[model samples]
Target: MASLNILMAQINTLVGDFEGNTDKVVACVQRAVQSHPSPVVVFPELTLSGYPPEDLLLRPSIELRVAQSLARLCAELPAEAWAIVGYPRTRDDGLYNVAGVIHGGEIVAEYSKQSLPNYQVFDEKRYFKPGSLPCVIDIEGVQVGLSVCEDIWEPGPTLATARAGAQLLINLNSSPYHRGKRGERWQLVAARATEAGIPIVYVNQVGGQDELVFDGGSFAVTAGGDIAAAAPNFEEGDFWLQYDSDHAQAPFSGLQVYPPLEEIEAVWRALVLGVRDYVNKNRFQGVVLGLSGGVDSALTLAVAVDALGPERVEAVMMPFRYTSQMSVEDAAEQSDILGVSHKVISIEPIYEAFMASLEEEFAGTEVDTTEENLQARCRGVLLMSISNKKGYLVLTTGNKSEMAVGYSTLYGDMAGGFDVLKDVPKTLVFDLCRYRNTLGPCIPQRVIDRPPSAELAPDQKDEDSLPPYEVLDQILEMYIERDMSAEAIIATGMDRQQVQKVLRLVDINEYKRRQAPIGVRITKRGFGRDRRYPITSGWRIGD
Candidate 1:
């Protein structure tokens, strides 16, 4: 039986660092050659300049940098083994997302990505022209087909490659992380392999970009739709697979096949990776957040500590007149448990000063939400001051439920460089807190047991201003995520007035969401790139 060894390099890459990205590719190729004789190393799509370069592809110097990087790889990569590297190729018409096969210090064969994903955080059509032909290359007497990320998602490219007489398919990808995405990828690859009557090697990039985290769950599947080998997700490594040509069907074998993470754990890991990469890639000193001892802030602090470590995370409890002693104690307890540097800065003095200044102007008017918001603003000011002085990124703790209904204070609680739970709803906030505690008791039980509050007003509870989170989250899922109208939501057995009010809050809060910071997107429809709405729209529900 003739056997072949293939190496999948699942790596994390920084965007626009041409030299750095190329160096990583070359190093991985060298390692592959050293470990497996005559092995073919497959890298993720656009390995040269990183994936989703966005407008960086439009830069005048980007082409030159890509050319230089490719030249370096051709000259320095091992001569005995074949290397499949993804990059951008310029043509007379436009640029193409291409995967080139390099052997013996020269370009042998190349495949351009055909399917350009334009929706849901992808804008590939803006940059690359689609390729029409299939690319099949000979590797050690084995016919191997080449396809980029989106090509394998649809049937055209893989089917074309099969018709061209390829025995195996290699799909390079930079697919980002979302809940249950692994199962989807696995099923897609298995089905494609079966349709093409060939085995497949799916290699994906692993790492966190600005708001996206690619969990490298690279693997191989048989023509029979069976997983032959798999690698760990949210990790970087060179996974090897052995394919026996003699056994034509179900040939690939070897390597550990790690199970997919459960939903809560998967979401938790995504948040941690997203926070870690954003801080490290942007080169922040560390992170700081105002821990209000509520579930949202508690979870944010825990995520920060997990991502940046206790020494790097700073927690501050800004107490106002309405702040409960239990809130203060719970905040202190969690900080001590996490071993993060904790401080208590009373906002009373600042609030008093602001009220005194506004006394003359407020003489004829009654105090309202303005005063409540001022308390929050005072906390924001203190947190931002610490951020500016100490070089830490302020992590806002507002969850999606609050952000959806305009429950958050602008320039107050919403003032930060990043919001850890921006896409997470209040119900999930409690779930995540419990999940984190399962790993370890980092959050205080009292914090989770207590009813959620802003603590900005006397005995203020979140339910006092909005619907119950359990009900509100359901309404939000239907309206915001599922794109159901208010009428449709009311049809789901919810109160008509409640549904109307929640929908109105979401509609009116578009301006606030527009100004919110980018965070990790765990859902199919996130506020930033996924779900886009016009802030000035006069569109109304049930019109």
Candidate 2:
């Protein structure tokens, strides 16, 4: 019947900003101590120096700084308050993604992460060695369990802690956001609580880190499988959850509730936050992109303007001879509708310049895709020039379907500091454009209804080189994202030759995706961290 007050700080942290993260952690603990009676404040995993530090963890100096910051935080903790903080831990062998329990000005208990995720964007296996021990800490007369991010995804870690006589399970997480992930986490946490016969507290990191966007939907589930308390998603806030064993009969916590966003809305918010944080945190003045009269660029521009504001977005329309007048007019109309600065840059001169330079080499050959690619590359050069001259970052606008099939040029539209839709499928790109227009007509309707084209060659359409997006995206979702074998994809009632051809395109385009700019991930498996394929492999999928 005893009650323990636990405060969860759903914080947004900048990656590699050790000092800022430490300062925020200190402030949260201080607030928790002052607002409640000897509260235990918990933060997300690796929150001391931010999550997924990438190669920054490889730098020894960064590790030293992280350790010193932890020490400084421990020194600043109040005598009555308990703080469970996450950071990097170093041993004789290497480093670890570790959590430290600080009480009375020292680390009372430390737990290193047992599960090191090596797949996707996570390279923890390459950086830190796993710890084998389960850490159990006493929090205000209650036996509390401790596990890092990936440990709770599997059952053994939670089951182990329950067997070790822990009454309450506390997991610190830095789980990233993808479509429908909140529901999935709720299901996973509820299952864990039911199996262990104990209450569970799950805290996830918030905000964007590079291409990864962390949606902070931290919550608590009771032993009987009910959401005892839940934090707001996608923002920073501190809330206290009072857990009373007797009050398990009545699940009334009337905390501030925010309904979950729809799948499309969630994906849109994640993309906006990812672009906002990546551009702002990296210290770019603004963003510039080629506003091709296509859904990919149109959606990219809408998301960028939404994230960074219209004034911060600059769209350049680089038209080629093959580009239709309707395409040109719609590009300008969309820019005007969005209230962003627009420029008309003709790539004809640059294309002519490149052709003249290569005239001798092309003396006997008829003009082909090589000439078309030159036009795309010409636009890329001009976009980069604007980016370099104005201190703005160039945002590439290619989508997942094109990127997967190598439908894009290497240095053409592919040139940029970051790509906004590199992982978004072509179907989702259209969906997003429709979603944006529903908010208000930010994009021209003509742009949406028109056939998609690269416009590098005369009257070219995407269907000329690739399958229809409806068909192509379905095959891609099966083969690329879901990891379904080509035969399994073919069983989905698709053309056998078409399925094989799309798979081949995906395999061959690995080299192009390798050099692609980091883009926001909307699917369960994105090209960013989750999808890592060999660039030069001889593997074939289907018959």
Candidate 3:
């Protein structure tokens, strides 16, 4: 019986860092060749320029950089290994997202990606011209076919490749992580395998890039639409699979299929990876966040500690006249529990000075939200000053619900380099806080139990200003994420008045969300690239 050895080079690459990415590919191929005989090594899509190199693909120098990297891979990689790599290829016709096979230190076969995704965080149609043909090659007497990430999502490319006379198919991917994406990939790929009548291998990249995070849950499927093998999610490493020409039970061996991460668990890991990469890639020394003894900030603190250790995390509690003693103590307790640097700063003196400066300006005016916003601005100034002096990235703690309704003050709680829960809704915020506590005593129980408040005014709670979170989050999800109209949401048995109020708030707050910092995207649609709305538009609320 003859068999083929395959290695999945699951890796994380920096965008536009051609030298670094090529070095990783060469090293991966070298390590694979040392263990297996003529092993087939597969890497993720856009491995050379990194996934979604975005506007970097527009630079004229980008063409030269990709060519040089490809040349270097052929020169430095071992001749015995057969490596499949992905990069952008510039031809006279146009640019293409291509997968190339390198064997015996030469380019043997090339496959251009056929399907270019253009919706919801992807704009590939702007760059690459789609390919219409199939690519097949003979490897060690075994016929093999090739496809890129979006190709396997549909039936046409997979069927076309198999019909081109292939016994096996391999896919290169740079698929980003959203909630429940792992199961979706498994079911979709399995169907593709059944349609093609050939075993399929899927390899994806792992790590974070700005607002996006790839989970790297690579897997394989048999011709009968069964998942034969799977690598773990949220990990970057190499795994092996074998294909046997003659076998009694199954054609593939070394099966290690594991179930997907539970929904909340997947969200937590994605948040941690997103934060770590954003801070380290941008070269920030560490992170500093205001500890309000609220659920949102408490959850953000725990994630920051888990990502970069406690030594690199710092917590500052800014107390105002309305801040309760209980909030002060809870913030201190959680900081001590996590073993992070904790400090106490009083914004009273600063707020007093500001009020005194504006005393004459407010001579005839009655008290309103201006005083509340002034309190938040005082704390924002303190945190930004600390960031400037200590070289730390300030992490804001605003949740999606607050951002949706414009309940947050500008340049106050919203002023920071990054917002950890920008895409996380308020109801989800409480759920995540409880989830983190299951691992250990990270967040204080009292913090989770208390009614949420901004402490901007005396005896004020979040519900006092906005609808209950249970009602607010649902309406926001319908309008912002699913694009449902106010009437549609009301038809679902929700309060019509509440739905209209929430939708109006969301429409008016586009300007604030536009200026907000980017954060992790764990849902189907996030505030950053996933959802775009005009800050100034005459569009009204309707069907």
For each candidate in turn, give its C-alpha RMSD to the true structure in angstroms: 1.2, 2.0, 1.3
Best lDDT among the predictions, by candidate number: 3
Better by lDDT, candidate 2 or 1: 1
Per-residue lDDT value at 496 in model 1? 93
Candidate ordering by lDDT (highest first): 3, 1, 2
CA-lDDT, candidates in order? 0.91, 0.85, 0.91
Instruction: Sum up the clashes in candidate 3.
Output: 0
The global Cα lDDT (0 to 1) of model 1 is 0.91
lDDT of 2 by residue, 1-543 (tens): 566788888898877888899999888988888878888889999997798887888886976887788788878978788888899988888888898889898889988988888766678888889988887877877888899888888888888888888878889999888888898988889898888887888888889888889999888888877777788777778877876656654332535445678878888889898999999999999999998888788899999999999999999998887888987888898899889999998988888888899989999998788888788889989999999999999999998888888898999889998888887888888888888888987988878888898877777888998889999999999987788998898888999999999988888888988998988887778885788778766775533
Model 3 residue 69 distance off true place after TM-score fit, in angstroms: 0.7
TM-score of each: 0.98, 0.95, 0.98
